[model samples]
Target: MMACAGGQPGTDAERPVLFSVVTEPIVCCPNDPDDAKTLSDVAGAKIDEVFIGSCMTNIGHFRAASKLLEGKKDMPVKLWMAPPTKMDAKQLTEEGHYGVFGAAGARMEMPGCSLCMGNQAQVKEGATVMSTSTRNFPNRLGRGLLVFSAISDGTQS
Candidate 1:
């Protein structure tokens, strides 16, 4: 049993406990040669397009990326942003992030589940993509192999 913030005390049984079975291989970041390749690796090996936004990505991440991409707009890399919601897209637009994107030679898409929904743009075969999307399973994006890494502790990085 745990004390409630303002309501009546609650018991552990009152909570809707959820559990799942592990069915996939869990590995650490790409730097682990025994595991997958890091973002720095396998990048540019054959990838031509890059995606930088998803439900996992937020305004702060966009801002940080914009700052890092300042004054450089000719890297020959295609950068795309798919805002999770219209409101988020609007907020980002109003905050001049679009301008930063433009200056950085980036593009934005309509609010949609470009990655999660699996009904939008897809990575081409034999192409590499650097994405911030959460659904990076085998061939989830397209015919090309989908690979990604995360914090060794199973936390968002």
Candidate 2:
């Protein structure tokens, strides 16, 4: 596996580079009726996955998704929550937010480098994954994988 040293930049030959973009905060879900008409209006496309984890996604993120799915219940997108630490997962579950996520078809994973490491229990080959992780490189997680950086507003694959 390719690994980057602390603050050390890798050359183009050494690194398997991937395209990425910085997007505006996702104030609402992409499927929300009031949001932008298309992804182009909010951000570019070619997204693979939608991640709802990492240190940046706080309780508020879950709350927002939960609220968005309230009453409607059956959310259309597939959401994966990977908290930065075990503590965060416990807090979310203890606070009864897990049910909300579950109701909306979201999966709460253990707090560790699971999917981000390219070792998810069920990722298919040639899958394009959108993530909140900091890096976007080839084979960083899975062989022939395509990874995309996530926006703050919760928009994901």
Candidate 3:
């Protein structure tokens, strides 16, 4: 936990504080290494699959996604949805967001590191994926995958 203090939180602080201002959404695309690209750079890009769960997502993010998916007739791409915790899944169920996700053809997974880690369910090999996972390292989610690390709203792209 971090607390606000009048001065530095610790006198031994060797690193300077830095602030990142995000005026627009960004996506971390896989390269020979990796690169952070503006969403506009990859607008209208083809995404074979999407994973919407990780430590980066919360109940609010799910709710917002549900709103976007609600009443949709068809989902063109494969969509995977998972909550970070059982409690969040329960809450979303109670709030009917789960129903919305289901109506949109989402494949729900067990909470906690579901598709975020290579150990659990993974997108098809060689598929391009937009994920809320922490990193887009090769094979982190699946073999031969071109992973893009982005926030929940990155799904809009």
Top candidate, metric TM-score: 3
Q: 1-157, model 1: which lDDT tens digit per residue?
A: 2212212236443323122333343322222223443345443455466676667666667676677887877868677777777887788789887788888888777776774444686666655555666656556556654434231222322
Tens digits of per-residue lDDT for model 3 on 1-157? 2222223445553233222344667677862223666789988889999998998787888888899999985788899988999999999999999899999999999999988886678889999998888888888888899888886533331
**Candidate 2 — which pairs collide?**
25-153, 26-153, 48-128, 49-130, 49-157, 50-157, 118-141
Instruction: Give the whole-model CA lDDT for all candidates, comma-separated.
Output: 0.58, 0.56, 0.79
RMSD of each: 10.8, 9.9, 7.0
What CA RMSD would candidate 2 show?
Answer: 9.9
Worst window of 10 by summed lDDT in candidate 2: 28-37
Deviation of model 2 at 29, angstroms: 19
List where candidate 2 sits over 4 angstroms from the true fold: 1-48, 71-74, 120-122, 151-157
Clashing pairs in 1: 30-37, 30-38, 47-128
Q: Tens digits of per-residue lDDT for model 2 on 36-145?
A: 12235546555555666665566666666667766566554456777767776787789777787787677778776666665664345566666665555566545675
Give the count of colliding residue pairs in each prediction. 3, 7, 0
Compute the lDDT for candidate 3: 0.79
> What is the descending lDDT order?
3, 1, 2
